[model samples]
Target: MSEADSSTEAAPRGGIRVGAQKFGTALSNMVMPNIGAFIAWGLLTALFIESGWLTGIFSGLKDPGGWVAKIGGWGEYDGAGIVGPMITFLLPILIGYTGGRMIHGNRGAVVGAIATVGVITGSDVPMFLGAMIIGPLGGWLMKKLDGLWEGKIRPGFEMLVDNFSVGILGLLLAILGFFGVGPLVSTFTRAAGNAVDFLVNHDVLPLTSILIEPAKVLFLNNAINHGVLTPLGTAQAAETGKSILFLLETNPGPGLGILLAYTFFGTGNARASAPGAALIQFFGGIHEIYFPYVLMKPRLILAAILGGMTGIFINVLFSSGLRAPAAPGSIIAIYAQTPSDDFLGVTLSVVGATAVSLVVATFLLKIDHSEEMPDLAAATAGMEAMKGKKSSVSSMLTGPDHSRGPITDIVFACDAGMGSSAMGASVLRRKIKKAGFDDVTVVNQAISNLEDTHDLIVTHTDLTARARQSTPSAIHISVDDFMSSPRYDEIVDLLGKTNSAEGASGSPSDGADPTSDSATAAPPAGAVATAPSPTQQALAVESIVLHGTATTRDDAIDEAGRLLVECGAVEESYVASMHEREKSVATFMGNGLAIPHGTNEAKSAIRRTGLSFVRYDEPIDWKGKPAEFVVGIAGAGKDHLTLLNTIAKVFLDADEVERLRAAQTAEEVRDILTEE
Candidate 1:
């Protein structure tokens, strides 16, 4: 990695900031994976509840004798209705199960879920907060309990002891949660509910924006949105049919205003990108797009804060709220959740907040008389310093890091050609091409296939050592995300300057082929026969499972291995080899993907080259990373390499990944996988 790329390590990390960030991350992760469940409940509530939209449209659906009325959960059927049972039981259990799984995998998940039911029965209100508390606690306690007898049990009785131990411990924890943790969390929730009520009653709720807007720019939006606001908002919505809390953090007015200000008054790239960013922020509901604008000019944060406050004040004045969280905080989602009675208030809130932010941001930009905008790269670095990690979105807004030396040839390497290397190469290749850096060449190769020809190499942190061994002479960069890394832009910028400088001076290229030192190996001349395209049969509809049931990483891998085995790609023994390979090195390849395959030594178990794809509804923890897409490989030879590249091409686009995530049928997934 370049020195400039590693600068965030040298930045000061305040104790409180680190702690808050960690805690917030934990909370967000617990809830985020279960957001689909929340959304499902939200949709059900919006359509079937007593005052829901469907009833407003078809009054006959409200009659108790009708099947529609029964499904809508009216009166006598309230408990049986999808909406009530979903919010009260399904959502909380899912959150608790995900939280526990985060700590102790499947075992923790089981105990966590058992404990969550106790809390659900004990609390009168929706047990979201209670579930979050008890779920992780249950997992942690189970992990500790298991540690006591770990490796102590006799081999033959291990499974027997494991099952009974969980049963006994879960029983105790469920009782404890019901009698002890449940009421305590209820009290805390009540206190928090009262506090929010207090703020709204005093008409001082708008002041919260003073803290929220600044924190959001610091990259705490997920933490604030999914962690704190979601739980409280859900509770309030359960009682009142709608909650203002959902509108607080989600209203796009502040970001929209700031971007609009830049569109009119800002200079250079900031001005040029602002108009499109405004559309994305306001309509696309990607609030992150506008955060860079405030980050570039710190004073503009006041505009965001004022805009936030303006929106909140308007919502409060009109008693407007939403029935559910507006997930992307987009205007469309906001309106979809907004009560019909509150449309005017919600509209005015967005507009009023935007107006306030625009006026303030425009003023800040106008007062700065410098012909050129301030160095946005410096500001982005500062933002990274505050975040304690690199911000891919923020860094994309900045110019190239002047600190790194020039580079011409780069390779992205991964294990077995069945990982994110191809995807990373595709992304960086586009960036290099767009930047008009014809002299730069980027390629993807398996670490095992790498030669000492490249000047620079990139690999996942877990696999960097292998890459280094393959090409020790090259500078190696470790990246977490292959699809949307900021490194792509950095390299583009560095090469732009280097190529420009070299072209102006008519200097020789820095990218000399290292292979000139030895006689080149002759390419194989014979035509190569390969198995049918992996997508043709290897990754056919039967190999794709859109709604996978594996809750743990090992389970997910096992499922993938089983699919491969069933497809006659490999023997059953290859499944154990897959686990061994995972134990040796993380299979996580970023963009929520994991590729599990046997080690080189285990290739004897492979019968043919084939692929298996399993996409889970919730992410399974792959080491410390979360994986929603698990691809299993049983490669007999190089025939599957071409298919790997195609897989990379399919997943390289964010929109494509979202489409895959939303795919309902196995055929839909297969079609997406085979799309040109």
Candidate 2:
């Protein structure tokens, strides 16, 4: 709409201009996804707050469940209530699935939905906790099902199977849940609810909300307000059986502040959204809808939080809530719920909070952008193009041995030679030593010299051009931030590829670290360091078989033993103790992957062995995985689990995953699993 927006329409083809445009574009991109998630959050929040447990807690305390507990209120029952342990439990899955469809299309949409649904119907913890834990399990299971469809069946058939399977599965799960698991879960949930009642009834009243509001405005309030309460309010809506966030709608104290200031101050889209956000929030409870405004100018967010908290405190101290049992505990809803004498309190909360938010937003208007945002028009075009090339992350990987490692040489770079690149290199060095790559040398230098051919050139956007000019053929890696650079998949891959290659060349027959200290010395000046070959990467995979007495816990020990002599991995002594049957808890990571390992004790004939390249036909929950394939590592002295910090990298890379997923044979999988 403005010159900034029009000129912004150009493509981000070449050169670096990560100015305000980049920041602005990045900020804008967050809105759509955030809104999608926020909508879902609202529905879930409402649902949980209205659950039999939370409501019953309030009911016991004579709070009568607030308007949120009333029928036809935002927290009213949805048709799905009786269908499972809860009506709102599946909201995230539904949202996730819908979101996936909108973003990724039909292929992975249902999978996301099904995966998210599983979290609700299956997990017993909080939404976020469940999302962190159970969410991936569901996704892993879905992937396996996808694998079968693609491998044994066909793509067309696979899609058909997936669609019907997901729908039918959802229904079947609901039915079975009703017959078997649902009641038990509901009963427990109810008991938990009573416990909540006891805690709330005896300890503190809803007064915490009032105080926490003011408390938030001061110190950690922004996080508590947005990161906690706003989301919590949104979740309340979901829990209450609403689709959109109605809670935030009624709570415009923070947003209104931003908007009113703009009306009284200058004009800009950033501040402009504030008024609209306030308007919508005032009527519909879409509180999170205003996040963009505050996020763009976070200094203003504190003011907004302060206002909201004050408003809430005063509202609670006085009057709030009215009419339809509002979702956000809005002033109207409070007024509706309060006695006639307390009506003034609700007005005070609304007006007071609005006044505060306005002042802060207005104050921010006179300031210039501390970090300029990218021009939206060109940024938008560039983003669209980049989205296509956002790079599935696999293509850039040149097998596992990406760098010429053994670390006699290390390079750290930054945009300005001081900021991020320098910081990133420091981080990489720390991680390197932590991973037992101690023999490697570390150096910090800017990318200014054209002839400086270091093993690896780590540079950020600011310093990348210098790095490029210096090392045209040198392995160049781009990083967004210094703190995050070393962790980037590409950087890790480049480093890991080389290390794995070095380790692989040590032992040709077995995957082990075979390199001697002398072999790792500096390469001759004229000698060219070759990139990793497929065979070298394949040899890098490590195998250890733990044949200890089967523990009642962790299946890792047993699996490690079987894998040690992996058809060809060798040594029956290494694998003998693996299956000496015993049952404690299963090695269930709740997915298809497992770390199945344990201690190998003395005075026992049992020896430990760990192996690789055996794919399970039917997935089993090994160390919480349904994984048929696993990378097993074992050590005799120190705790072997320590290696997980590094190996976890294998599990995290999208590129590595693609390669691993594509493997059909044990050898093919081995090629991917090898340390590289």
Candidate 3:
């Protein structure tokens, strides 16, 4: 099977996973990036609400006797004054900006905010859910309009058309939101609040976790907390000083219990990573940290459900509730949100739920470990191998073929540019500088804002298609793991070789030469080599394997290395070197390809700088990525760097990788490689 087919086969079937994935992505995109803002808002709500502890303390101090009275009066004023306006106006704009950015870009964000103002003005309650819906819709509509008029607009009228379109769309959306969407959503909000009130009054509130826990695991936690519970919680807090609805979804007990189970009872990296994850989940209030653990062992989701139900039951039994939403869902946030009277009840319920979940998760995990266990090293290798599959799937779907150009600038693009992509760009920048390619600029950008002027783009496999579509003329390199990809090293090697080749020919290029005494220095006479190009020397028809099989990354490397040996490219000892090199860093490049090579220490074992290509219809797991193509290299010095560059270009094109995988004969494979 091709890599794309294998990826499709690996995905969880049915509409459920698809729906869950979309919901999770949308919710996370709206909330995760603005966590700090949410925390600040929650803190303000907890401190300033009329019945809040701070507000009450300040109200008592309003009796004029001393500085305490003066300060207390000011505090009370601040709470009543600043909090209301913030929730009414600012909160919706924040939510709108995030949602709009997720769909379109900065332009979408501005329009989304404009539309959200109408929602905020039309509703008495905070229009959190309305902002979520309208923001993305506005952005999506604008994007569609932009795409439609992209090339049809007359010359010199582009900016005029773009600005007018955005303004007109924003105005229309805002009007629609006020006239239609706002009143409808306000009614829905009232109905939802009434339903929750009914459940709380009838003592059936605990049963809500039957839906909440499952949805939470599927990444709908933000939707439940901010969209449903927060509005209800605000109403209750105004009248009763608290609401059990807030605790229903924000309880950290269940996630903590699962992490605790894994920390102690789970094997390998799962156990090792669980302790840190547990700390982050409970104390840090990032419940997302434990999501992968639950996903990896889906049965563990039952633990979350039982624990959540237990916590809610205890909460309802004691009439416990929070004064505001717990923003981080951390223990600290929960405590901060709790009313004085409900503190003991909330703490008891949280602890009780934690104990229940821990017990349940421990049992489930023990059952999971009843079978054979791999050693730490082997398990770590297996984990990394599995981790790259998502990115690989992305590359397959979005063919990464972009026109080759002079690579003056490299961009690392992701859904959001501030996180992993930024780090990856920094890593590459440092590597490039170290290689003396100072003329080449490297930067990070959101996929939505990626410019065509960028000559090379590096992005996560999942974002590769978007990057390719945005900058089709730039060379694209997709990686499964951004932090530790060997592709960066490969790029540095390629640049160095290119610089040397250009220097020898006295040709100016974008990359600077490390060894050059002056910027414009020319190579001495007879510097150019007499040998055939690295491309011609590396690939041979004899070294190509049309059909190959390997269950593991190491096995795949060994198979490729054996092919090189059979083709007289390298000695038998070179296979061991290949494994040693792989042990240091994964060779899997996103887009269903892996390039395994030996360390410099094994350079003497190479008879020539040669390549062996092996195609695996049933892909071998390369770290956490599937590799349908394994290209083994036996290089002496920098002789094979040019060949590596050629291979990198071919792998960047998803269609080319598929075509190479489908080649029936060694001659076809050689022809494809030589065509580069």
Candidate 4:
């Protein structure tokens, strides 16, 4: 089961909320990739500016062309400093290029960087804002232009046309950026700067925390900090030595305080997990660890908001700010970016916020006297709902409990037992064996067949609710990708830790040798020739379709079903079941692929185990995600699972998928699927 399913089960989000998240994601994507450049410039500013620490260290030095004077952009050689050029040119170009790549690919990156130079040259101020705007715009324009002639050019003229088209489009976009976008964005930047100044002057800057804290929990921290604050903060830092904007969203105090509150006052799993979460939140700087806590009791958001305001108010009162943006918002990062004179102020701000948030969170938790333990899984679901994606870090709070005993029995559940579930089982079985956990047993089954006796239940995010209803006691892990999910690694690590802990008290179990001949023994010495396994007979060149014409998911599934029917692999009624299973839960597995299979109840329609493979020239929309490869499956017995596992292994590698996609003949496609 994959966690990558659409958030259809999450709370309803209006267009406004969805649009804001998408837009913010786009904006953050541009700046987040270029954070290294921002950090480099920030370090230079902190250490090399005229009032920097280096200048004070060499205060009495009299060398006019010394390294300090030359590097710091101070003394007699002030104009030659690298700091001005970095923020003015290098940072914005990097941002622009990254943003362009996000929209298109390498071509977009090239044109985006070229377009950014125009903005940098046109504006006297740093062009971070301009880069953000022009970079994606440049890429989008190139994408649209390419679409105009996509696949229309003569065979031999493609390279010539592509190169000249990019050159011409890039030239035009650059000129337009210089004459129009650059100056326009510079004005907007100034206006936004003045607004921040207005809020700061009135001592109401802390009020912004009301929005900031809530947004952070909703997974918009990166969008707010990198997209909005970093650009504004950089421009401000260029003028003054620092900007308070840098401290707004990066303050770890609020999150630290909430986790600390949970450590002391939280009950059940929430309390047990709080201490470790605090460590990650404060020092490791993953604020997401505490988000599920807030979602568990949404009123805790008030605690977070108040805590954030307290920190901002103290910073404002002391007129203290960091010289650069803190990437992770860790305590160490904050201190590193703090100017020497602002240490006391920064320390007090963190302390004050923690105290206030701790008090508020404690009060909230105490009043909720319900004996029922908070459902961290449900809260996690809510967080994912709000964020519109599964969070990799939040898994720590909801993962399998080692205290429940060793995870010996693991099961994978999907819409059908024979499709992706089997594939996921194979993937994890290999991983578990490699980690020397041969004592553990891994298997796959339909969600309806899930049993509470299992130690762990793995399922797609969409089927999680059903799996839980059927096997509520089992620790459930939801994933998005069956073949390559990080959860598999985390599970292995968890097993290692569990094994080591158990070893302290008793002799460890001598696990079964997975490689023993008994496990892989061949059939009895051949007395007579036998038929191949169902999986071996499943794929043929006749069953593989290249350059498929199915434009819609239903059409693709129907085509695949027709192939299975013609091959005598399944009855025609199984085709209808494939559609029925798809309606209940999409077969859109990740990695540009989908596996359309009949539901468990439709098993009687299958005459034999077989698979039909189809590769479309263009992507087919499978539940809003694109699917270029659709594998229709029918399994009367378990033999088909082996082929599905083989296919899963092939698709797991991106290079292999491309090779499969580029195959010119059905024979080539069949060879790729069946190859060892």
Name the best candidate (by TM-score).
4
TM-score, per-candidate, Cα-based:
0.65, 0.33, 0.55, 0.69
Off by over 4 Å in 2: 1-252, 259-302, 313-352, 360-557, 561-611, 621-626, 634-676
lDDT assessment of candidate 2: 0.41
Question: After superposition on all CA atoms, what RMSD does each candidate show versus the true structure?
Answer: 11.7, 18.4, 18.5, 8.5
Give candidate 4 misplaced runs (Cα > 4 Å).
1-15, 363-381, 388-676
Q: What is the lDDT of residue 158 in candidate 4?
A: 69
How large an RMSD does model 3 have? Answer: 18.5
Colliding pairs, model 1: none
Question: What local distance difference test score does each model get?
Answer: 0.74, 0.41, 0.67, 0.79
Per-residue lDDT, model 1, residue 492, is 59
**Candidate 1 per-residue C-alpha lDDT over 297-317 given as tens digits, one digit per residue, 9 for 90 to 100:** 788999999999999999999
User: What is the per-residue lDDT of model 2 for residues 1-676, given as tens digits with 9 covering 90 to 100?
Assistant: 0001111221232333324334333223222344434433333333334433345546567544444344323244443232233325543454444444433334345555554455455534324322322233334445455545433554346457756765764455434433444345445544544553453445432334444433322222233333333333333323333211122224557666765665565344433444554565566544444443444445766666667556655644442333122434344443433323334665676788788777766667656435463222232223323221121221211123333544346566532222122234445555554454544554444344335556666654334444544554455454543433434445544455566555322222232222211121233321212333422322234442212222212233445555554534335543333322112112222123444322132103222322343344455443233555444433332122123222334444557655666665545555454443
TM-score of 4: 0.69
Of 1 and 4, the candidate ahead on TM-score is 4
What's model 1's TM-score?
0.65
Clashing pairs in 4: 1-459, 1-460, 2-460, 2-479, 3-479, 3-480, 4-480
